[model samples]
Target: MQSQPHVPGFTIRLADAEGGQEQEGAPKATRGFRRRRRNRHGRGLRGELMLPNLPGFRSRSERFDDMVLDSAERLQDMWGKQLDGVLFAVDEIPPNLEQLVAEGTAAPMGSCTPGGRGEAPMVTVYRRVVEQTATGREELQDLVHDVVVEYTAEMLGVPPETLDPVYRRRYQ
Candidate 1:
């Protein structure tokens, strides 16, 4: 019989059909068996190696950041030069209780800071609040886009409908 390939800390043994051992070396079979056994119970060496390659592996905060950036890019396409001085940002959540109390709300989805004296205006989207408010993936995308549009419109001193003709279409 052909011998099995050698692995670290493993030895292969071949046996006759009668279940008698033909050759034995260092209990090598146990190494492979150990690996299989570990994986069967939970994540093991194999899972560690493959985890980084799996789709949708980014953390929740990272995914939220991606959504914010993507929403900004789409708005940039629509606004062009008008968006040149706007700085887009994402925070896990808004700052302390002061701001929440000031707004008279339990959650604030986004905020805008008008720049002064050579500084660019900044728009901050609250990741955790927006994410928690969304019911699903498509809703999340729409909500993020809405927040961006609203903040940009406020920065430009225009209404959201003026910024995008199709802003918030329900049936379309």
Candidate 2:
């Protein structure tokens, strides 16, 4: 039982019959020529668990953005030049939500801000609120489209039904 030199942060193990010293319970050293992969627990090389084209690959916020863009494109096809300078956006929640709740007003699902001082008209939907209000994916898509249409209509000074023929059709 020959004693080994003490190292500050590592435990030294005695040389085995192969005549190479190793750290206690440590993996054997590999040759530099051996390629290392990011495999874990003998699983294959690390990569996306789901394909990029899969629905699960996209985040909720990204999917929400897509819904907004889809609705915007549909509206753009209809309104074209009128929607040219309008901006569509999404926020996690409405600002001053606590104040609105304290004042007995529900947090807004969306808002329409009229353009002024060279700023473009903006429509914003509160993502969390709208998502919570919807029960399923199809419902969420419809709700998001309706919210965008509603705000766009407000900005254009027209009723939502007049702006989009399909507005509120789900409820009817």
Candidate 3:
């Protein structure tokens, strides 16, 4: 029957059978009535607003990767044996950006590295540079494809137009 200390916004109640006092004014939550952790403000769970099947469900980087893959696949079909061991990659920025800037050259959209010492030829697209150059999603996709085509052409020692007919048409 001992009285507990006063707690603001709560009324101390008699001890229950478990020998623990209750706070009468405090919210009582049952197992089934417990508040949701993510939906505290009555909104639904914080998850993807768009369905997985929707185009917007994918992130910008993921969409960019898909664009690169699509371009690579298209090129692969055209040059199967030649592109066999060539690796395609995406990087946020080019490594030699500082040097390029020091030399007063524009940042390259992509780079081509020829294989030597049993290494594979690699084509790397600078994602940030390419994204900055394009105005819209369609433009981004086209630019990504063009960058891939240009680097692939460089790796194979051919002009971009020879690698992809659309490459010449885009500039004209």
Give the TM-score of each candidate. 0.64, 0.71, 0.67
The residue-by-residue lDDT of candidate 3 on 5-112, one tens digit each, is 342222212112222335779777554222344555776676645788887776777677778877877786666667776677777788878999999999999888
RMSD of 1: 21.1
Question: In candidate 1, how many clashes are counted?
Answer: 1
Evaluated at residue 63, the lDDT of candidate 3 is 77
Ranking by TM-score: 2, 3, 1
Top lDDT model: 2
The C-alpha stretches of model 2 lying farther than 4 A from their native spots are 1-45
Instruction: Give the per-residue lDDT digits (tens) of candidate 2, residues 1-172.
Output: 1111332222212112222337699997774222455454676556667787887877798788778877887787677667776677778888899999899988899888888897667788889999999999999999999999999999999999888998988876
Q: Which candidate has the highest TM-score of all?
A: 2
Choose 1 or 3, whichever is better by lDDT.
Answer: 3
Q: For model 3, what is the alpha-carbon lDDT of residue 58? A: 69
